[model samples]
Target: MKTISIFTQKGGVTKTTSTINISGVLAELGYKVLVIDFDTQCHLSLGYDVDKETEYNVEEFLNSVEPIRYAERGKHQNVSVISGKLKLSTKSLKRDSLKKPLKKIEKDFDFCLIDCPPKPINDDLGFGEIAIFASDYIISPVDYDAFTLDGLTTLIITLDELQQREKLTAQYLGFFFAKVEENTKDFKEAYRELSESEISSLLFKSYVRKNAFIRTSINTGESAVFLKPFSPVSMDYRKLTDELLMKIKIDAK
Candidate 1:
């Protein structure tokens, strides 16, 4: 099984949205996909409308004395999800109980996408380190803002440090611009500046445009691909997924 972690140190960058959409795209393309909501907020779980009925949250898998099965086979199709609850973050419970359950889940799913928490929580409990160690690739979502560049830099540095300290070998998949508004001057400027920088190669050419339909789809517990496959936002995600598949193929070689 191949593991990918959708992560960012900063919040409000659509990390959970990216995870849910990407998983949906992959599943639509006939891949067996499992999304693990590692964040304490449980937004990914809620986005799929699996929050309340989910029997086993991430916390249960970690804290339970016996081997836990957290994944809920989706009522729809090939997609499955391991939900996360708000209480998972209360005592830093998710961070403490991740490793074993993750290993088990990795064995079952063909592709595992982890929706990681924000940077502060990751750093406080060294969750990022564990995630980096386990994943085959790391996908970071960055906004079209000046400060996001700084966050990207910190992410790169953290990965480098993890590589040095742990001899980690995960491939860096680089950044995807999320919720971008290219018509706006500030957004255009930020994109232009990033394009001209040294990190340009790491920035994905396909970016997600800010779209209400996409948000509405998530809110309604349906994927953008399912709700509006022909929309520009859906097309962008398809492109991003194509790029990701290419990277995964190259890495597997």
Candidate 2:
């Protein structure tokens, strides 16, 4: 099975949205996908409308005395999720601790997508870093306005350092622009700059433009593709999924 982490140092960049949307699209295409809500906000958990009273959450799974449990089926048939809890970030988890637990359940799903938490105030490394260590590829969904030099530098440099020190095998897949407005000059300029930057080679051709339908779908606990399959943004997601599958050399069953 393949594993991926959707993370960025900055927030409000559609990080969780991208993770769930991609997982949903992949599931729609007949792939078994597992999405881990690695954030304390529990947004992904709410996306699938998982029961808040469940005895098990990410916090329990990570810090259990016994074996780590597998993610359970969500509202989507082909998708399973380990729901994040309110105090998830407060738990002190070991570096690479997830590697074994994920491996145990890897055979059950075709792909695992982790929705990483936002960077904490003082810590240099957190669940986001750990998620990458357990992934095969890293997708950074960036909101151009918030992708500041400090955030970019810290994220990039930390990845490089972690890859070396942790002996991790994951590689960066690319950056994808999310919540963009094609009509705005500022948005266009930002996209152009990102594509022309030194790391231009690591940019996905398909970008998710601002779509009202996206919020509508999210609010209703369904994917835009499933709710409004013919919408432009839904089509963009399909194209992005196609691009991602081709890049990974995985054929849809």
Candidate 3:
């Protein structure tokens, strides 16, 4: 199975939204997709309509003595989700034990999409390195803002250091511009600035447009792909998923 981690050093860049939308679209296309919500906020889990009272959360699965299985099957389309609890990030589980739950679930799904949390304040590099180590590809959702770009630079540096130290093999699958508005002067300048930088090569051609439908869908516990399949935002996500699949195939070669 191929595992992709949706991550960003900065939050509020549509990381969980992208994860849910992409997973839903992939499942609609007949792929057996499993989404694991690793963020402490549990936003992605809520998007899948998984109730908070559910007993089988990621924390319980990781710390369980026996083989853990997901309680809810599929909510949005054909995609199954492993919900995250607020306590998942507070457990004393080791990295090896944390990895075991995912490894066990990987056998049942064709694609695994991990929604990682924002980089930790104490040690940004540690979380990025561990997420990269577990993923086959990393997709960074970026907002066209100065501070967000600066955060992206820090993330790139962390990934570079990890690759040099551990000889990591995961592909950096490029950035997706979230909440983009090309008409605005600030956004236009920000996009141009990022395009001219060394990291420009890592930017994806498809960008998600700023849309009210996105917020509405999230508020109602639905993905944009499922809420408005014919909307521009939905089409953008579909294109992004296609490009991601192509990149994965090329990387495998």
**Greater-TM-score candidate between 1 and 3:** 3
Candidate 3: clashing pairs of residues:
none
Alpha-carbon TM-score of each model against the true structure: 0.88, 0.88, 0.89
Best by TM-score: 3
Clashes of 2: 0
Per-residue accuracy of model 1 over 16-108 as CA lDDT, tens digit each = 888888887888888888777777677888888885445666667666446555454432476788777675544554332555566766666
Model 2 residue 94 lDDT?
A: 65
lDDT by residue for model 3 over 181-202, one digit each (tens)?
8699987887777788888888
Per-residue C-alpha lDDT of model 2 across residues 135-219, encoded as one tens digit per residue: 8988887766744534765777767776787687788777787787878987788778877888786678888989888888888
List ranges where model 2 is wrong by over 4 Å: 63-76, 120-125, 146-150, 250-253
Task: Report lDDT per candidate.
Answer: 0.76, 0.76, 0.76
| Superposition error at 84 for model 2 (Å) | 1.0
Which scores greater on TM-score, model 2 or model 3?
3
